[model samples]
Target: MESETVTKRKTSNETNKKTDSLDDEEEIGLKAKMTLINGVTVIVGAYCYAELGTMIKKSGADYAYIMETFGPFLAFIRLWIECMIVRPCSQAIVALTFSVYVLKPFFPDCQPPDDAARILAFCCICTLTFVNCWDVKWATAVQDIFTYAKLLALFVIIAAGLYFLLNELQDPVKNLPRAIAISCTLVTVVYFFTNVAFYTILSPEEVLGSEAVAVTFADRCFGLFAWTIPVFVALSTFGAVNGILLTSSRLFYAGACEGQMPEILTMIQIHRLTPTPAVLIMALLSMLYLMSSNIFALINYVGFATWLSIGAAVLCLPWLRWKQPDLQRPIKVNLLFPIFYLLATLFVVIVPMIASPVETGYGCLMILSSIPVYAVCVAWKNKPKWFNKSLSVMTTILQKLLMVLGKSNKPAQV
Candidate 1:
């Protein structure tokens, strides 16, 4: 498996991927990998490849960084996989989710029209593409506003939960003994992920989305603010989509500028100083994905694919140490750290596949499916002349067409 630095896709105020997580949280049953395996995985996996994330920051090019530690072929394959599948599909997933949330508020009584929602999702991607292409500053401003809105909404939910818990349970510690007993069963830090799923873990029904929470709250209490949950969810989801659009486009742009992708992808809008070509490409790919799959499918696929890169990166840590002994390290860790993480990552990835192959197998295939494309990309030099000519022609047309976004177009600085 090829790799990148980050596996967890660190969420912050700026990236509230709460929409997808809400669905995961709603899943019923306490079904999980054995407690022993899961517990060790929880601790070892927390900092998995964190050092490689640092390496990428220090080295600047994720692919180039990997090349320094490993070789060009591996780096190229990783970049190829990322640019071709991971990013676009990811953007599409987010837009699809945003569209679902956008329509959920109004269609509370029924399922959203798939065709209509797909169209709306496409429009959302198009709108965000233009937002990114119109100007970098304006795109950033939109992101900032959404980030704050997302955070505020998240805090509101948390505060509301805490309030309800306090009011309902006069002896809040009443279950402390039972909790401790259950905790003893898990026996260690493994409860980290399981603990978050505590509420829904044992539930029998599916946890489709945070819609469950909001709906339940409305049915039981807080009727006055019931409408607010849907509204805030829409806002937060929109913010997440915008943030992902901005970042994912930049990543594609950077890959192109570094020559890992076709030069046509290097275009920047002169009028707005933005990666207009990359932004549009992302939108096109996202829309294609929106037309094909639903939210949960995308989520499962993305999560499974991400771990491949993450696992590969963790495996690089020891190699990097010997390969670049003099490399400046403001912070360092023992070899055992990354080794444990690598094993933990494998356990996390493999155990689930074994436990529920039907669900995760498709995602694993999606990740591996990049290999054929990667072979074509890296072996373009050996491709037939006619194919090369056709590719060149398409590239030229796209370059000229996308140049409409700029007055004095320039290649990305890197």
Candidate 2:
């Protein structure tokens, strides 16, 4: 009887172990599916926005028109805030953030690295510079190829995620909701802030900066796959960074052409037809930015300004729709889209403002500094025709205000 009982117990233990293994596999599959869904959502959203912006420009009103309608001072402030301060600072912050994560394991106290690590860091910077200065077209093509690969990789990851989530279907409802809430909150905040950092500091040459999405994923998956992940991470991030550099430089080049900035900036090399000068200038400035310890603080300031501009743009959507009913919108933002964008923008603006007093103070000063620069460009140079129209509108508004006060019929008026 004792021998029989021992055998039955051993069999039951083996069955339980097999069941647990199956559950683990199912959980992983579910998690991958969820991740894929998230990835697709992002790709679709980005494509829509990019296409929409291009369509708007093609319709009639270009950047100048937008500037004229929005106040030139305000527009100039926005441009300066984005191009000069925000973009460069944000890049430095991202590099710093990644450096922190990469180096943390080696140094428990998070102290500066010793000579060996510093040497490695220097080598990385040199490599980054080489990548930036290489043939623009080739770089762009490479980036495109990698971007598609990254997307595919993300889909695979998502599939894995979904598989894992599905396997956990028997989990309690409260646990699931809590997990979902935490996951969404983390993804939204991290994704949004990281992009915010990218948009603020990104230039043509500096593109995606030090850390790519692949690098981020690799870091997360380090324990599971070890060295394999690092190789994939390097390839994925390098491609992403290259793409970012191309897009950013183009934005600056376009801005320069709009007469909102120096016309010299619009100049491109005839041979390459690339904005080599702008790229060089932006890269040098970004490198200088890297030396500063206060880089992240500066990024916070840029974040505030960037989000404010984005919020203003989103708010203007409703106004634009009502004011220019006939304006062709190839892709209209859904009502809910604008609302959520606004709320997100508002949160970004408020959070940094409340958190960093010095940054807020410096941001205000930077904005004021743009006024004199805009004045000189408008007064002496061949200003865009819209500048006159804007001035005329302002004069009309001031005159109307005076007339209203004058008609009040007080003794002081007599």
Candidate 3:
């Protein structure tokens, strides 16, 4: 679970942007070296998460760990930023990428139509949401199939580079770290070599200028087979959308489980035994986000808050070690892992302010906006009788409509 979850975190949609980012700074010559350095930094953070995931053993990922370590107040803030902005925006962006690739072949001479792409993206979200709400086994089955298909596409790219060079676990306590370590290492190598393949097939200027690096590489190297690239990319992004929905719904369910989110979100389908309400809410949010014209800008606007929340969660490692010396920890990372990861995270959140002040400012405001929301929805004890009655009635209606029961009911697993 951790391996697939972490691999999906390094979604393929961002691969081209990484090349563009390196070249945007006129550092094309050093892209390979910098990629290695960045990979090392990410591996350190992955280890930190592996340790935390092992200790907490919760579904919300960062949100779950934050709640355990930081208490409800701070946890709610992280939850707000994540559920309101990050997850939905990410799902929209990746789904849109999937649509664009799927439609690219038809519009060879031009960009895909926005309306068509968005409609396709909407359909993709709805399909994945239905699968997720139906059953966990079904979702994982989809994940497993697409994960392999995308990996084959990735290896095809890697093979073209050298024409050559070649390519989870039970007992999470002992095996989870190994799974995470191996997953991160493989991802880093694949990414690095894929970039090398791009550079090998296309010149530096070409790489910097091309809108879709993989497509361009395929055109250059796979002349008769150029069309396969778009198909491969579409499959990759579509699978990524499925993976994101699978994980993000769990985050919402975890929040509701702890009473941080609406009670409806904690309910699972009595028949399918899946988190139906939470999955539907995630799909609805992602669709709303797809309507935004500047989806990438929305991502930038939440970048600071995303890293900040993750850093806060990682910081909990050391704090917990000190605060609860006797807390059972099946896995404990070296203090240096969290120390380095926090430092990298600090650099991430702070540097963006100097580089993109407006977006960073908006990110800060978005996070701070949660305070008033927290005060009203979570913190304040007193509430009007009518408001409580309305909420209760709404929850009851939605539960029956969705054929779900609250966690308290403990519906039998299918």
Candidate 4:
């Protein structure tokens, strides 16, 4: 009887061990699957935005609308700021934070104080900026390639999502104009203001903002399939930043090399083929701004500038249409498209002014802030000669002093 009992016990133990092994294998498999899904989703999302841009361009609304309302100078300024400063900074902060946040729940003990988190966020920003500035070649090779892939992937994801939302779900409200407007508006505000605060405040040693959407998504969807979404989002945005940095660096380099900026900005490290000085300068300025009080206000100020610029761009459409009517248009807007674009631009322009007192007091502040910068750049360039040269010189001196004392660099310079 005792021998029989021993044999049964051994058999039971073996079975339990096998079951445990199987469970482990299943867990690993699920994780792998989730990672893949997450990556794909991010790629698709990015792709959707790319497609949207293409659509906007093709519709011919961007140029025609902007030229008509804001004039070329303002339109150009708007494009320059959005492309060089606002979008890049915002995207970088969001991407990096979101990526880190996605891993947070997995390592619960890693959570730090808000201040500490913000500091770490600043470090991340500095690190990435340093990498981009350290060597143009290295930055170009690693960052740009990854960014292209990311953009392609995101475009795919977004297109797929739109399709799914519109077709697969077959929701009646998918095509509703009001719904589209609301959704776009929300996304625009989130995208615009979040980065300003992120660059201006959260880059320091303190954590101010909430964990990113990607991380939030990860926590909400603990399971494999669900967790994948956030992972993909992180990947997509990370790559997007890579691309933004590449373009931005080149723009700065070109400007500086052409004598449009301070001579120090043109310095390039021979070994890394990077703009070490430029990167360091930019990182310092961004950090100082971030560490200062009322970072949110600065962010709003930046947002106001960005929106005004975009509005100007929208207004340019009519001028471009008239001046370059014979120019080849890759994308053509319908008769109604310009009207729609103008209306949207008007709404964007007016809403902020109306909401400024209650929300940010940002409407005129941003315009005032840009005046000096624009004046200086114009004087330095001296091509069109729109603004006063003396004012430009004064503003430039003040800006330089602020940068020197505060260790801050403009995104445009970066």
Candidate 5:
């Protein structure tokens, strides 16, 4: 997620400042090249995802592709880790970033109180959750409006990327690749120039030392108008949170449809045609994670898991080709793309383990923890009828309360 890296960069900047001091010209040149390299690297994954998305035609981006190609156990583990750690933590961290920036102008010469920021973050999450749950159209509308808002902001700052919501596209197989190509190209150009602008305007030391790089850039260039930068960043991160919620809820809904999650999650509100249960559950989990002081640190660990899951999914591109030779492929990518993407994901997953063993260990432990959960809840399918009945009853009551009908019920189209 772009939002994941946005939060990760804050802490990383402090570390870079302490560890490496370089001359301004050398620093700017090095950082510019790194930005270009990073942009190219992301394109590889974008291609891989575009292929998998068209091939699978499912909502849960990585999870859906992995399940179809790798089978249930691995997919379930990915789903579990994503729901429990990656998605929620990423959302919370971004929400915190949003809150901080939204409150920045108000605080002016000082930082906002932690409690106040967190409270606002919670409200942001809840508001978006409601937007997601009440209607799919509403969620996308929020994504679109703020996306334009952020684009205008990015026009000012210059930066961005896109993914998820492929299933919602009318002609994903045809449109997906085009969207990826155009968006990735635009993002790559914008991000590279954005960094160039940063390096050109601010000294290397300032770039490395600042908490919010964009805010610092604005401080340097915007003068008294610097306050507008915070508002732009706040809008940017706010849209990011909505994008994450809009997509992550689909993972939960997809898991339910696959029988890996409670059946109720597969349901949609009758009137709204939205996955209310899935959205609410995701929102609740994100809210819980907001209470953790280690939310930023957890990004390091979850980054490990996130890349791992994505790597596994990308591997499926070739696996399915070899396994199911004649499966309908709306688009077939060259084998080289997935292979290169897998190598990139491998580098991503391994570097952290060597550099940050404790964080990597936590990520590994979290992935392994899903094993017992899968064994008990998923693998053990022969539960007593009473237990099954109890679940069905609860699902029924909740369905009534939420006014949702399971996908299996196939409520008539309006």
Candidate 6:
């Protein structure tokens, strides 16, 4: 009973994992070239991230890859947009979903509690922030355990699903049109990490258009409880939240550490050995986002924005290669790779306009609107007095909060 809980909870059905049975059938039925394209897309993405990471390593600055490739102005703009808007919106969506899935299993009617979900989401963000403030080591230690447990949970799910499917169905179900759809579905599942973390079940509405294959099969074959799925879903999504929180906070702290942003954001708790102020700031922004937006609506708005940001960064690969040909690259993906990659990404960004114009337009507008704000906010020349003063005050507040929570309040160093 306990083992099968997660399979019942997440309805979108990537957990369906659809087996290699589906993929083998799809390959035989669909044109090999089509499957080849989707398969290569995944490979290219993996290669691209590796190339980007190498650039970051060789450059030795957190933002150096962008700065060296695109110049300081573009670098500053990317920093402002990412830190101020993109990461917060993303983190909020993750937090909200974490709350929804965590609360969902108890409601067997499939109707999750919206008010409770919202409150819990808000509290989850705050609690994570509070724990990190109290002690970074303790918070990370807890997160590490959850991270492993998440992997174990996923292993349990896939293993169970596969065991049942393999034992019952020796032969693959081959259907031509279904092949194309499943292929696309598989690609989407692998492409978007957030899919793991949903309002409407995309697999049912968009991919399978019915009850998930795994769900129906599990019911008929194993007669498992309907409640096993959400727990594992929650476990994985919670791990994702922890990852997002830690990585995003580090971006801001490192930005401040490099003098790219206000130094107050750089405040580290000596006792806790964490960036307490930056963590709190991100949590507060995440809380604000949760208060304001609907989960699906936020996902829609962020989809375009995130892909745009990612595309911009990915496009930098060719620049880094061209400008610094002499630079030691751990892995070099050719110029043509990024060229094709950019076109592929352009299609991804443009598709939203055809499918959902209003949401995608608003998203693009939100990203574009950052330009003038970037102009005003980034002091490429001299530090503004008010900016410095604000940092001093915010730093003191963050430092005092750290002390009040535990350690003696000596002047906190940024």
Q: Would you list the C-alpha lDDT of every candidate in the order shown? A: 0.61, 0.52, 0.81, 0.48, 0.80, 0.61
lDDT of 2 at 373: 82
Q: lDDT per residue, candidate 4, 1-414, as tens digits?
A: 999999999999999988965665455455445544434333333332232343343322333234334554453354345434465445445544544554555554454345554565566666577668665666667665655555443443344334433563374123333344455554443433333222222222222334443343234323455445445665555555545555544445444443344544545544555655556655555555455344345555556656565545544444556665665444444434544555655665576666665434543643455556656664445444334444456545644543431123332231
TM for every model, in the order presented, reads 0.73, 0.59, 0.85, 0.52, 0.84, 0.73
Candidate 3 residue spans exceeding 4 A from truth: 1-29, 164-173, 410-414
Count of clashes, each model: 3, 33, 0, 56, 0, 6
Superposition error at 227 for model 5 (Å): 1.5
Tell me how far the alpha carbon of residue 170 in candidate 3 is from the true structure, in angstroms, after superposition. Answer: 44
Q: lDDT by residue for model 1 over 94-126, one digit each (tens)?
A: 666667666766677776778877888788777
Q: What is the lDDT of residue 4 in candidate 6?
A: 71
lDDT tens readout by residue for model 6, 1-414: 754766566542664566544654453334334445756665565567566765476332325556767866667666766776677778788777777776655554454677888898787777777777787676777688777766565454455545544665675123423443566556544423222211011222323432222233223333456344555556656666666667666677556544566565665666667777677778887777887646656777777766676677777787666677787766667677777777887988888889988777777777677677656556444657877677667767865766422133355333
The lDDT of model 4 is: 0.48
Compared to the true structure, candidate 6 yields what TM-score?
0.73
Q: Which candidate model has the greater TM-score, 2 or 3? A: 3
For candidate 3, the per-residue lDDT at 402 reads 89
Error of 6 at 57 (Å): 2.7
Ranking by lDDT: 3, 5, 6, 1, 2, 4
lDDT of 2 at 302: 69
How many backbone overlaps does candidate 3 show?
0
Greater-lDDT candidate between 2 and 6: 6
**Residue 226 CA displacement from its true place in model 4, Å:** 8.0
lDDT of 2 at 234: 42
